[model samples]
Target chain A: MRLELETRGTRTDKGWRDHDGFVGPRQPGTGPRSDPRGDFPTGPEVGAAMPDLRCLTADGPAFDLHAHRAGRPAVFIFFRSAVW
Target chain B: MELQKSMRDFDAANIRVYALSYDEADALRDFRDAHGITYTLLSDPDSDAIRSFGILNTLIDPNDHPWYGIPYPGAVVVSAEGTITRKFFDNNLAVRAGPERLLWAALGEPVVEPLADQPAPLGVQVRVSLDGDHLAFTVQRDLVVRFDVPEGRHVYAAPAPQGSLAVDVTLDENDRLVQRPIVRPASEPHALAGTGESFQVHHGVFELRLPLAVNSFSRSAAPDITISGEVRWQCCDDEVCDPPASRRFELAVPVSGPPAHALRDSRAATLEPNAAAHFRRMSERRKDPG
Candidate 1:
């Protein structure tokens, strides 16, 4: 049986494993693609000013990263899903 | 919610934390309440912020339900002036920089634990320890090698002048351990008056950290894993140079299981009974192309 990988998503009998070993249907490279192997881009270079992030807070309020944190040092994380 | 465990410390240091995901606001709200996570959780369901940041995971098809709109999992540490200081992007999505690592970036110093009472040393002292109590799958912890040089003596830094060995750490061949390059403390400039030779050296108390994580494909789910490695260095004083030195280290660290959501008996599962329903809703909602 031919196994599909990467683009178009992979499906299999035992379940597909993502770059990080997250095994599940439609995975092996699901949400938060972990495989650092391929041509994946990690955001913003160091020493550059961090651009503001505009999004909705979990509380449904409109949020701006720079506005929210004020001048405090911050650790910003981009993750997969909370549901999954 | 490992971040929850250190929220007080983060707050005490005046460092704020925020995590973003493709999850909808409602889903994030449910996750926060269930997990008792006090830190901010931002919802980027449209992935606009993710795309703007140039990290949208383009490998998955845009139509992929629930998986679409996710960013390459990583962390960016920003200074109080909004300048990006350091970025932690592990090749594997399962792994993330440990809290201590991030805190170190924000606070400008390693999160040093109290020194264990080790035996007295003959010359330069070396002590190896793990940053955290256990090594959890995908969570990167540090193997910290601390050095103590005698008052007038110092250890060579990287590029130890010709014919000399620089201080370094090398882990034994282990498929279970995913490793990152060594994080060395800044070295001070040293000059030799007699020969007019100059080099970088480290004196007093300093540390070299090696960030490491255990992949999910570890051969066994054994409770404890042995991590063995070697530390090498050369020390010198103005008048005398000590012979090069090396020390082998072995640490039997405990392993933590995968994330809480994957376990039935986890505290998160007990607190969030409706997590499954929330996940189902999330899947169904994504079925509709927007």
Candidate 2:
């Protein structure tokens, strides 16, 4: 099923203004949609296709999921800390 | 005990057990050494694999800790075709996808067994509240129900001492709980307590208290304070105590006062195309084999 994965670091400006009724001037180079390409500085754009990459095994061998999947199914076990 | 026994069974079956994490190599090595972990421990420091799987959640603040901005904890069983056959996701860190269930899925089998005139202990409700650096909560009766044991059946004591059953209460963020549970042990020790205790009992009621570092709580006000946690323990009556089970629960604690002044709206920073591309590229590089 198609999933719309929200980009990791997209920010919204809903609470930008202060209580003094002063419409804060957009900072230079920080206008609405400044980076029209949707490339977020803080992190990757949400929903963008993840790039194909390889992981180096403990034995120093590199393993690529896409390459290994060469038609076979593979499980991408996601974990926060390899140490955990 | 049966669950531990089951884990031993799985270990003997030659089924692969891969424990994935975002920790650095050194840290992983240390963890393996400390736990004597026999399973595979894989590291994903860049979180590339987690993000690609569409299981990342950036909104959860890390309470200004150094180890922040990691992917949510989850497990997905992928078919031979690379499609996810079964997926388990947890925003809270303390919760984990059951290893046995995952193994069952990998083997294309149903993990849960049918109730045989006796129901397994089920955790129905959980509540967590921040008491300074400690988290206190109660597991209602319904949540602690276990199968009926015959008149003579008994189980071993929980990991804690005779009176104190140490039920390790951990946060959803997976932060190690520093505080010990305020375990109120039974007044009488089971005949089995010392001499190779086989059966234990958590009769009508029990309470647990655990300590956590205060800094784990987020300082941000707009987002509201939320706490998630899990309990891993086995319950048994007189007859039979089913296999061990782990249950996860979450609670949201609201901050009373106005928003904190230190909280800044970091949204003003513009998205940098180059930076985003760089991160994406880094992610890809980490995942690529050649």
Q: Identify the runs in model 2 with alpha carbons over 4 angstroms from their true place.
A: A1-53, A65-77, A82-84, B1-8, B11-14, B60-65, B109-290
* TM-scores, each model vs. reference: 0.76, 0.36
In model 1, the Cα lDDT at residue A8 comes to 32
Give every prediction's interface RMSD: 3.7, 12.4
TM-score of chain A of 2: 0.32
lDDT tens per residue, model 1, B1-290: 76677788889999999999988898788889877898899998889999999988776677666676778788999999999999988656667888887888888864444356954455888899999788877788989899877778889999789999899999998867778778998899999999989999998778998988886555466888898989999988999888899999999998876566622445767766777777676667778746
Instruction: Tell me the tens digit of each residue's lDDT in model 2 across B226-273.
Output: 556676555454334456556666654433332111113223112111
lDDT of each: 0.79, 0.39
Candidate 1 deviant stretches above 4 angstroms: A1-34, A38-40, A45-49, B110-122, B151-164, B173-176, B186-205, B217-224, B236-243, B262-284
Model 1 DockQ reads 0.45
